[model samples]
Target: MPAARSGSTRSRPIRRWCRSISRTTRSSRIVSTRPARCARPRIPISTRSSPTTRAGGCSCARTPIIARAARPPAITAASAPRRTRTRRRRPRMADQNLIENDEPLLVAKSLSKSFGRINACRDVSFSLHPGEVLAIVGESGSGKSTLLQLLSGQLAPSAGHVSYRMRDGVARDLASLGEAERRFLFRTDWGFVHQDPAQGLRMAVSAGANVGERLMAVGWNHYGRIRDTASDWLTRVEIDTARIDDAPRTYSGGMRQRLQIARNLVTEPRLVFMDEPTGGLDVSVQARLLDLLRSLVAELNLAVVIVTHDLAVARLLSHRVMVMKGGRVIETGLTDQVLDDPREPYTQLLVSSILPP
Candidate 1:
C-alpha cells in the first residue's frame, strides 16, 4: 500500500508539470502570432506592450514586433475645432469682393442718332474725361445739339449704347434709363445750357427762385437755405445780391445770362452741356462772363461740352475740339492743335472765319 501511494504522488507531480508546459506553450504562441500574421501584410501590428496601449493579436512575420507609441486620452472637442472654425472664417474671406471699384465714368460705343428721316449723328465716338471740356463745334444743322441731347439722356439713340458708370459700380444705360431714375440720378448729375441761356431759365421766376426751383425739383424744401444757396451762386456769377429776389425780366440781358448760368451751376453738376453759353453778349460782358465761367469750371472741376458755330468760343473754352459739318465730324483734335492746323476743308473754313483781317 505504501509503494502504491508513492507512485500516485510521483504521477500527480508529473501531471501538474505537463499542464504548466501546455499553458506556457499556448501563451508563447499567442504572443508570436502578431509578428507572423501582421508585419508582412503592410505596416506591422505590434505586440510589445506599454501601460497606455493595447494591440490586437496578429500573426505577421518572424521579427520583433513594436507597438505604436501611446497617446493621451482623446480630446474630442479640440479634434474637430477646424471644421467649426472654417465655417466662421469663410465669410470674412468672401466679403473682400464687395464694393469693388467702378470700371469707367462714361462709355459710348458707336453712338448714332436720327431725327425722323435724317441721320443726325453717325457713329460718333468720344469719351469725356473727368473735369475736362470737350467742345463740339459745327455749322448750323450739323447735329451738335442732337449729340448733346443723346449724351445727356434727353434723346434716345437710334443705334448703339451710352453707358454711364457711377463711382459705386452701377452701370446705367442712358438710353434705357426709366423716367424716375433719370430724374433722380441723371438730371442731378447733368445740366444743359441752351444756345440762348434764356432757353434754360424760367424768365418769369426771380433770380433766387430760378435756382431754388432746381432744389425743389430734386426734393429739397428748405426754402431759407435754398434761397441762400441761390444767392451764393448768383454772387459767384457776379450778379448783385440786392436783385436776388427780383424777377429775371427786371434784369438786363447780361444779368439774365449770368442768372441763367447760376441756375445751371448751383447743383454742381458733373457734366454741363452748353449750346452757346457765350453767345449774344457785348465784348465787355462776354469777357467778364467768360472769366467767371472759366473760374467756376476750374473750381468745380466740371466736364463740359460746349457747342458753338464760333470756333473762337471753341478755342477759348475747350481742351479738345471736334469740327463737324453736315451731321458728321470732319476733324477732331486737341483744341489748340485743331484750330492752328486744320485737316479738312470744312474745318479750315471754320478756322478761317476766326482770323482777324
Candidate 2:
C-alpha cells in the first residue's frame, strides 16, 4: 500500500505539467488571430520572446499589420497640355472709319473768351476726335491762343461752353468740374506743352524730378520705379540718361523742350495741348522735334490741339487745319485741302506766304 501511494504522487505531478503546457498553447493561438485586412499572409505564432517584453510570445504577432497603396507615376512637361497664342490683326480702313464715327473726345460750341470789352476769342465751334491732330493756324494776334486756353479750361468762356469726354465715357462741361477735378485732369488725363520750355517744366528741379513729379502727383510713391521710368522717357525724348541729374535751367532750349515733352508724356495723357512748340527752335531742331512729336502722337493715339502761326508746322503735324483771321476761324477743313486750295481769301493769302521747300 506504501509503494502504490508513492506511484500515485509521481503520476499526479506529470498530469499537472501537461495541463499547464496546454493552457499556454491555447493563449498564444488566441493572441495570434489577426484581422483580415492585414496584407501579410497567415504567419505562425512564435514561441520565443524577449524576457523584458513577454515570456513566450512574438512581439510582431501581437501587433496589427498595416497595408498601404502604391505610389502613382509623376507627370512630366512633355506629357502636359500645350497652350496656344492668338495673333492680333491690324485695323483696316473700314475699322478706322467706324472708330471715328463712334464718339468725339472733345467738343466746343460757340466758345468765346472776352477780356472786358475786348473779345480775344469769338464764337468758335469745333469737335476733336481721339487719335486726331487739329492745328489752329493764324497770325500772332488771331484768337487761336485764346481759343486753345478756352478748350483746355485754363480760361472761362463768357458766351458758350466746352464739353470733354471723361474717362468714364461721360461728356461734362469744364466749368461744371470742381477745382480739384480740373487739376486732376491736368495731372493725369491732359498735358500742356507751353511755348516756352521754362513755362512747362519746373526749371529749379532736376530733370528726373521734373519727369517724376507727374508720377508722384498720380500716387506712384516708389522711388526706384519712378527713376527707371523717368530714365526711359528721357531716352525716348532723345535726352541722355546721364543728364538725368541736371536741372532744366542749365539745359539748352531744345533739350529743355524735349525734357518737357518727356515729363508730359510720362503719364501717357489722352490729350496734349501745344502752343507754338517749335516757335523758338532752329530749322534743324524744329524738324527733329516735329518728327518725334509725330511718331509719339501716332504711337499713343493722342488727341492734340496745337496753336501755331507757322503754316508749315500745321501742314506737317495736323490732320485738319482751322484758319483763323482776326478773332474768328474763316475756314476749317482737311489739312491738305485747306492748305492746297483755300476757300477763304485770308486762308489763300496765308497759304501763298509759305516759302517753297
Candidate 3:
C-alpha cells in the first residue's frame, strides 16, 4: 500500500507541472496581443458641441495629426491684429504764381561753388524781389552762409552769374563790374550787417563815427550833416542819442547789434545782406530787435537776403524761406507755407522741431 501511495504522489506532481505550463502559455499570448489591440484606432463618437471639431467643422477621426499640431491658438480682443500705417501725401507750393508778375530785383542763375572736390553751393538759383525778405536757413556748414557770401559778392562763384539791377534800370552782372564800381555799389546801393558787431562796427571808434563813416563813403563830406544823420539813426534804432559818442565795446550785445543796424541802414540802401543780425542775444532782446528790424525793413521798403540757423527768426522776419541741406536748396516757398506745411521731409522735421511760443 505504501509503494502505491508514493507512485500516486509522483503522478500528482507531473499533473501540477503541466497545469503551470498551460497557464504560462496563456499569459504570454495575452502580453503579445497588447500591441495589436493598441494599434487598432477607436471610432470617434460625434457630439453636438465638440470643442475641437465644432468650430473647424472637421472630424477628429479624419483630421491629420500634423494639421492639428500646426493650428494656431485662439485669439481674444486683447490680441487684436496689428496693421501698418501709410504715410500722408505732401502739399504742393504755389511759388511760381506768387512771384510771376514782379521782375526779380536780384537774379542768381545756376549759381555754384566748389572747394576742391567739395561742392559748397550747387546749382542754387533763386530770385529776390524789391521790398521782399528772403531767409536762407540751414545748419552750420550746409552752405547757406556761403550762398549769401556769393550773392553779396564777398565770394565769387565757381560757376554761374549774379545780376543786380542798377539805379539806371540796367541789370549788371556783379562779377563783371570793376572793383571801384563794385565798391561804389556796396557803399550806395547795398548794405551788409555782419554777424559780429566788431566786424560791422568800427569798435575803436565812437558809435557816431561808426555810422557817419558809411555816409562819408557815399560822399557825404559835411561833418555837421553826417553827425546829425548819425544821431537821427541812433534814435531811429532805439539807441540812446546820448550814447552815440560811446564806443561799441562799451555797449551791450543788443545795443551793439542795434548800432550795427543803424550804421547799415542809415544810408537807406536799396538792398541789405544780413548774417544773423539777431544772433547772440537774450530771448527778450531778440524779440525786441526783431520787431525793430521788421519795422525798419518795412518802412524803408528794403530788399534783404538774411542767413540764419534759427527757424524762428526766419519765420518772423522773412517773406520767403529757403531750406538748405548738403549745399543744396532742398525746399523753398513763402514763409507761412513753408513753416506751416513743409513739403520736404527735412523741412518738415525742421518745422516740427520748433518750440511753440
- List the candidates' TM-scores in order: 0.68, 0.73, 0.71
Mark the 10 consecutive residues where model 2 has the least summed lDDT.
15-24
Q: Choose 1 or 2, whichever is better by TM-score.
A: 2
How high is the lDDT of residue 338 in model 1?
A: 92
User: lDDT tens digits, residues 39-140, model 3?
Assistant: 111333333322332332223322233333333443545666877799875534345434432677799999999999999999999888888999999888
The whole-model lDDT of each prediction reads 0.69, 0.81, 0.79
Tens-digit per-residue lDDT, 1-357, candidate 2: 011132221111111111111011122222122122222223332223212223332222232222111222234467567878888988997698577648988999998878888878888999999889999999888888889899999899998999999988899999999999999999998999999999899988999999999999999999999999999999999999999999999999999999999999899999999999998899999999999999999888889999999988899999999988778888999999999888888888898888888
What local lDDT score does residue 4 receive in model 2, on the 0 to 100 scale? Answer: 17
TM for candidate 1 is 0.68
Candidate ordering by TM-score (highest first):
2, 3, 1
Residue-wise C-alpha lDDT for candidate 1, range 1-357, written one tens digit per residue: 011122221111121111111011222232111112122323322233222222231122112323221222233454545653444545352253232211345667777888778899988887776677989988889988888888888888888878886656577788677788887764477877775766778878788888898888888899799988988888888888898878988887788788877888777777788877778888788788788878888888777888887777677778999877777777888999998988888888777877683
RMSD of every prediction: 13.2, 14.0, 26.8
Candidate order, lDDT descending: 2, 3, 1
